[model samples]
Target chain A: MSEAPAVRLVEVHKAYRRGAQRVPVLAGITFDIAAGEFLALMGPSGSGKSTLLNLIAGIDQADSGDVIVAGENLARLPERLLADWRATHVGFIFQFYNLMPVLTAYENVQLPLLLTDLPRRERRAHVEHALSLVGLADRMSHYPNELSGGQQQRVAIARALITDPPLIVADEPTGDLDRESAADVLHMMQALNRELGKTIIMVTHDQRAADHAHSIMRLDKGVLWSNPDDAAAVQPAGQG
Target chain B: MRAVPLAYSLRNLWTRRLTTVLTAGGMALVVFVFAAVLMLDQGLKDTLVATGAVDNAVLIRRGSGTEIQSGIERAQIGIVEAQPQVALGAGGTALASREVVVLIGLAKRGAPDSVANVVVRGVGAVGLSLRPQLRITEGREFRPGSDEIIVAHNIRRRFEGADLGQTLSFGGRSWRIVGLFDAGGSGFDSEVWGDADQFMQAFRRNGYSALVVKLNDPEAFDAFLLGIESDPRLTVEAKREPVFYADQSQAMSTFLTVLGLALSIIFSVGAVIGAMITMYAAVAARVGEIGTLRALGFRAGGVLLAFLLESLLLSLVGAAVGLAAASLLQTYTVSTMNFQSFSELAFGFRLTTAIVLKTLAFSLVMGLAGGLLPALRAARMNIVEALRAA
Candidate 1:
């Protein structure tokens, strides 16, 4: 692992405006994740975990403070440049899998590579290899609607990894899956982190899902606790 | 920056097949009206323009706009026939046709109670030879100095008592139809033809209505026109036959063009609105998909282009459908009163490559007008809010 952290948040804060009302989601907080570390973020609904993940993934801007991922300060990057930065530096996995319904598994996995100047033959080879990594070599031609929830999530995983981005941000990746499917997706994610040496940040409310990560962090009411024991003590009841 | 794949837009339209078809159908109806109108105008212009040969010149009274309203004295015809520019026919005679054009009211074929004016043209001996396109398609040619006549194919099909072997009561006489001739889809197809002397005796006309003369060299038309017009003894003007016929069609063609354009404008408004609604619905339905694309590093411009492309494809489909339907109109003939000549002229729709290009450009404009706002909305969506929508 590199000595420098893969993701660093310096007193980051975020809030959204609903009509005339301002709703703060993330308070000014600082944190870092070492290169190649697999970290899980757990919180109740509306605890800003997803917001933090989104900020780290460069999909959302911080209202104040700096968010540095893969050594680039996201708050300083222009909107157009941020998209390009995300394309080559960050991968995202969403709760519902977010595969284009019209595309087959292979096409969905190959979507990100369309941004590159890669030859068509090379793109095909890369897409096949990514689908294979997710153990979906035979299912490449199946659409999202035709696949099980687990298989769709695997397709999403392949999509996120296709560009070989340094950092992966997954938001409740297994939330919509059955128990077996959830386990299967979690195992694949773990394999990606361990075997490929990918830096991962996952947001989930399920403690078992969080346990698969190397360490866990919890957010509550726009505040974060890095200590696992302290986080468990302050954890709200009935929040998985 | 990379664009959203064209396949993405295509597949999305296919996925919403019902919406796509309904929107495209509306556009198709508008394009049909637009294309049909242009074709009607083109058909009218083509029929009249094709009536006169480039080498032929028509001489009528100084201010007469059409042959029906003109009178050429016998002395004037004799002078025109003697011109050196006139072409020599068989037996070394100048190819000049002293024609009489008159209108007779006839009952329409299917509507017996409705009557329309038809042109009855009396031509000299060499008149059929002057118009090379005129061919006897059925029955034999009318004998000279007889009451027999040859009805044009269009006239024969459209009017009662115009068929071969039938007799038409007109000009205080009953004229027998001895032949059916096809004028190759020219304006002459709307006229009945017979011997000029016979028609003059029956109609009690003292002079010819017009004189059609074939020029020895088509390129010498300017000199020939100047000589005829400058003659103090002749109160007549000369026009290239094609130009004269083209002028005859101007009023009716303009009327058709205006009417067609007005209808297309009115119908296109509805189609544009239909397209806008369809695009808006598509944007609403794919809010999550748009956000997913944005999150996957696709720029706002790419999303906008994708939606625009989808709308263009829908309109292109509609244009094709409308053009196909309009092209079928060429197979059938229609008759309408020419405002200039006040005679019923039959013509069929004519489609050209220019019309196809115009239809496509029109449909694409409709698509762009309808799709722009919705596409902008999709492209400008907040990524976080859109992701939450999923």
Candidate 2:
């Protein structure tokens, strides 16, 4: 049996009022994401894909319409409640691998656990498990500066999974990685989606990385273009 | 919804080890100077204020500002003690003694003509019983009819022939220093004590510098002063012993207060500037990290609080350093001319816990004020811009 939808954006609109000009980024966009689904959003720069991801993660608010994620109406929530919702239900992985420079990889993984009611022993267990899953358990004590770009991104992914959030939003997670490291990272994401049955919504510009997702959707000029046949024909390379 | 503890702030401070140490050092220097001035003022005031005799009343000539300038006829000592409010000793004798004061020149070791002035007073036989805290640490008390003298402990090492068994020439007469005594570190420590009759004859002081009269009861001080003022025959003014000492310290006390305030103001400005520079750098360096925290469900308020705490910790370091440096000044001595006595007086610096605490509090205030603008700027930053910042 399939679970309910994890995220839904209904007729959502986002606009910026720049010196008397109303520039709408997302005009009446709508979508639904089922639980345990692997969906990829591919688009060029400034195509509103990242903005749509931010709205679903509750990191940004829409100008109008409903943004329901993890069963709550995110658009109707207050700022403080939205922050709490994001802390508990949504995990974010950014393109820059924004791990705190002062904290070690283990401490970076433990960041989201600080917002939980888990005991120290339990939090440590979760952090260790997440790092092992990303295959960085040996580098737990190393600071971000001591790690390479790919290693830093792995730490960021560990931080996201440590909280066990149902919906993970990754925005250009391999944008700064080399080709070999990027392929290794794509394999890890595919395994997380297929083996662990996690729900992931990734926004990227790379078609090769997009092929790993079960469904690939294109976004351009604030509109989504879906073609089921093209999405099925592309196969992701394993452990390349 | 992570609740930060004191450890969070402390750990953050430890993370920026270099910045923390430098800022704390600067604040410490400020507190040290501030504490030194306060302690010096307290020490000077304490030296004179602790010498009061609860049952004794001092008689100064009307309108005379200091004991050095106040004198009365030798015969009037009897009449002043005969007042009804006067206390008595054994054999029904009145509890009054005559005292004479003169400024003497002295020299410090390895220093030229330091030329500090001190009071040399003549006390009667009953004077020893009037002050119980006085103890002769060396030799014997001066003989009542002989040209011998006792020196206060503070004056013993401060001049030539001030110790016991030493002889000195004063007022054209040779006198022997027969004893050394300690008077609980009071105004009495600055004086030389001798036999009243012998002192009067040698100095040709047919008049006494002041009348030291013990009252029948301490509670009767106002009544005694009123009784003395009502009589035209006795042209003397009476005051409580503690009140008189405090009045004498007023000029120097005021000077020290102004000095302390001036130093604190100037040093606070420097401390505030130092704190501001450190906070600005901290905020500038942590742009993307701040954005991550903001995205991780922390409000702008939390980030602001964290930075402010960092600033406070830095300033506290400076305050601690300043206080420690100031504490070392406790062994230092300073000499200044007393406006009331018109003679140079030497006093030692003192550092107390209250002064240290006040300096630290001032440093914290400076830290808060200095860190405010930078912390607000960090809080007002756009999350997207901060994340995109290189």
Candidate 3:
């Protein structure tokens, strides 16, 4: 059985403007992500992995080509509409957890839901549910500074899932955690993909963290290469 | 996102307490100066507003701004009294009197070496009875027919030799001060009263300075004014007491308004600059945090609005502090040169609701102005670069 891709990038190109210089970051990259699939993107520094993730997540614009995430062409959307699309359809997890230092873990989980028209009682229930999903219901009132690195990452994951977006894009989710903590986070991500049927696209340099994904895609010098048959395979050419 | 903004910004400010305090202090000083200027304007206006009494009308020479320069002929007094608009006294005579106003210098009591200006008025025998509001708060009223004088409550406290039985030399005549009186905190509270005939004879003045006419009805001011001005025979101007007092305050009031606006603008600019610097520092310190927010799907406009709200919140705190301190100034009397009266007039700080509201509103504007550019800079930051910095 096969599932349709949740995200499809067709010959996408991204460039940066630095004092009249159009320095290219990603050039003619193409990729697809299936629904409920766990995908890992492996790349060296400056290989455009983060840029590609930003483009797919609708956080940044692509200079050219179609970025269809959940069947919506993000590149053609205006900033306001793009923001609305992101709010409803995408969830992002950062390497540092990025929890607001002033807010408790529960409030951090509640952040994305504030953009919705949910009633206060309903929003609270959603946040509580998200926190419980991360196994952090007891630490809901704890601030980011008061929590450990692994706990903070859990809170971030909870925040990413708060809006129940169809797609979750995690940028080095385990980059700042210890080995055991990283394994715990990897387990949580696997559970989210398997049990909740969430389609996740994660970027990580650690092979051990990438080992949990069902598929591995590699980008080299702005180009993407992927395996056709193996459950998890990295193309040697792109890896280099 | 709405809840995140306030939560994040407030926590950030709390984390950076030292910087926030310094920024608040700078804004507070600016607001203090702004509030003081407004109070000065209000104080000057209130001082003159208090001078008008309901039953009185001030008759001056046509085209003159003050009683000091006004000259009404002695012959016109009979015709003015004969006008049906004049109120009748107990003896069936018109209740009107001629008076002279002049500025005099007196040595201040506490600052004995410093000279200050005081208004000395010459009134008819019926003048004391005309102003029934006047009361001798200390010492006796001056003997009506003598060269003795009665000093206003405020004048006696500020100047030397102004208490009962003390002597004051004015226009080559030394008069004894036998009374200390008050006239309900009006401009009359800043003057000294003496017999008009004796005062004019000693000062070598042939004509009265102005006439104080008690009208039959307060609303008859226009008719009385027309009767006095439109007649070719009498070259005089007549106005209701309240209207005349308002005009008399014009110069000082204008000065205060100009000073208040100038000070508020100057201070607000400084406050805006301080707020800008503070917000810029905040943006710089939170580069990574802001990037995280962007990466979490917050649009640039949301980030910009959040910072602007933070700045406005800080400025409002400062504004509240400044306004509270300024309100305490109601009892603080300051000696200033009244341009219209050409005297060192004493007025207390006046805190009006309108001025307070305007000052706070200006502070809010300052916050928005100062926060806009820095917030824009923060919003425009590249997500990748910010993440890399983190």
lDDT of 1 by residue, A1-240 (tens): 549889888888888899999999988868878889888898899999999999999999999988999899999998899889988988889999999999999999999999898999999999999999999999999999999889999999999999999899999998999999999989988998999999999999888898888888889888886563633332222221
**Residue B17, model 2, lDDT:** 91
Listed for every candidate in order, the interface RMSD values in angstroms are: 0.7, 2.4, 1.9
Q: Write the per-residue lDDT of candidate 2 for residues B1-390, one digit (tens) a residue.
A: 454334445766788898888777777777777788888887788767766787888888888878889888856677788888888889998888777777777665446466677677888777777777678888988888889988887777676557678776777788898899987766677778888777777778768887887888999888888888888788788877777877888998899889888988898888788889988988898888777877777777777887888788787777777777877787876666678887656576777777777877888898898789888988778776687673
Residue B175's lDDT within candidate 1 is 89
Instruction: Choose 1 or 2, whichever is better by lDDT.
Output: 1
lDDT of each: 0.91, 0.80, 0.83
Ten contiguous residues with the weakest lDDT in model 2 chain A: A231-240
What fraction of the true interface does each of the listed models get right, in terms of native contacts kept? 0.70, 0.43, 0.43
Give the per-residue lDDT of model 3 (tens digit) for A1-240: 666679888878888889999878888877667799898998898888999888888878888888999889998998768777888888888888887788899888888887889998999999898889889999999999999999999999899889889999999999999999999899999998999889999999998888899889877788777656546774432111
Isolated chain B TM-score per model: 0.97, 0.91, 0.92
Q: Which numbered prediction scores highest in lDDT against the true structure?
A: 1
Judge the docking of candidate 2 as incorrect, acceptable, medium or high. Answer: acceptable
Error of 2 at B75 (Å): 6.5
lDDT of 3 at B23: 80
Give me the overall lDDT of model 3: 0.83
DockQ list for all candidates: 0.73, 0.40, 0.55
TM-score to true structure, per model: 0.96, 0.86, 0.94
CA displacement after TM-score superposition, residue A135 of candidate 2 (Å): 4.5
Indicate the worst ten consecutive residues by lDDT in candidate 3 chain B: B1-10
